[model samples]
Target: MGERVLVAHQPAYWPWCGYFSRLLDVDELVLLDHVQFSERGWQHRNTVADRYGRPVRLTVPVRRDFGQRLTEVRIAEPDFRERHWRTLSETYRRAPHFNRFADRLQELYAQSWTHLVDLNEAVTRLILDALDLKVTLVRTSGAPPSGTKTAALVDLCRRHQADVLRVGTGAGAYLDAGLLERAGIRIEVAAYAPTPYGRARSRPAGLSVLDLLMHEGPRARAVLMAGARTAPFTSTPREVHA
Candidate 1:
């Protein structure tokens, strides 16, 4: 009934506050599950803050097939989940709101997950539910379009009937403004500026939304939206979030 806003990104593990911030005002989210797996990216790992204000990275080992899409990658280790849970418990057990979300997170880690993307999606879903963000989800792994870069994104926009594509500056190098305009989809800049919720002052402003949740609990939603905003798209910028 109104102009539709859409955001698309690969699933991330223990996503940061900014990740959920992207969904704050969008109508739909396209999980780019069909994209090639990146070994160095946040798709399978994220950082959390240690009790002593240190940054600790948690990575999930993934077995990537030759030219495998994200959806096809498998988790390489069985004990990673247990280790991660233990690490979280050790790091955040003293956090003010850890008890509020511990049971759900523990239950999540206890489940069996085979695919890397599935685990990331589950983590995303867990955070989405915790934040109470209501947005439609569409995965391209089941039927990915045949193209690379901007063209594929345009196709996804058209396919989903998205009136506008809301993305962060990191996508600018790969995104073609004219192409989106031709497709009748406008590009808007959406991003999260970190508001310190008492974490190490490092590259990733808020270690992870998980950290934010531990510290701020139900107030995280407000903290997340505090720095989140959208504007007309422009130059490429390096992403600084999990």
Candidate 2:
């Protein structure tokens, strides 16, 4: 098999530290948009504070009545951007450094965007473009044999002709590593270790990539790679969590 990586992650808005951690170590990142949505999760909502420095969520509306699995689910709202902006502005309007990137973030949000898939693809492309990362990004929708859970992920790797499956740290709990090894491919877990950063708030330590970007700018990529570590197999979830 050729050099490649398959990372199956649920689509998250502006993704968090762990997402970028996997991106840095892999050659290709695959979003598992077809997976089930864990409720109260990053799938349909993410946090941005109000002007008061308190957290507020920007939500993607889902069909409350739609009992279909996440693979069958689609973003139901038409006015995603407008609602996102209004909520964000109200929350971050009072934040300490809200003025710094508020306008830019807001402008991007207000653009003529439609479709959750389009929005997800656009933001993913934008963030990668901004970071100048060379990794190939693909969605599960485009991959062959889009199954669910382990079968879906394994099939993606097989379809991509990958010899090694690069999984996020915490995912080991749910993945059958032994099954993968028997299939003649290695399983590796990637970690997003904390990098030194300063923020307007005294609450230091690693946070979302937004915290890194706000504090580090272009240099953020360096921190992302160096601080994001990768390792070979372990069935225990602790090492994965590490």
Count of backbone clashes for each model?
Answer: 0, 8
Q: Mind giving the per-residue lDDT tens digits that candidate 1 earns over 117-219?
A: 8888788887877788877777888889667888888888778888888877677767878888888888887777888775443434547789888887878
Stretches > 4 Å off in candidate 2: 1-3, 49-54, 69-80, 86-104, 112-114, 143-148, 200-207, 240-242
Each model's lDDT comes to: 0.82, 0.64
Q: How close is candidate 1 to the true structure, as a TM-score?
A: 0.92
| C-alpha RMSD of candidate 2 | 3.6
Note the residue pairs that clash in candidate 2: 49-91, 50-91, 50-92, 51-91, 51-92, 51-93, 51-94, 51-95
Q: CA shift at 231, candidate 1, in angstroms?
A: 1.0
- Choose the strongest candidate by TM-score: 1
Q: Candidate 2, residues 1-242: lDDT per residue as tens digits?
A: 45676776666676665577678656677766655556666766665433333455567776653444455556676678788777656655554445765766776787764445556656666567556677776776554454556666677778878887887767766887766777677887787767664444342333346545555567768877766777886877655333
lDDT of 2 at 86: 74
* Model 1: lDDT of residue 196: 71
Q: Return the TM-score for each candidate structure.
A: 0.92, 0.78
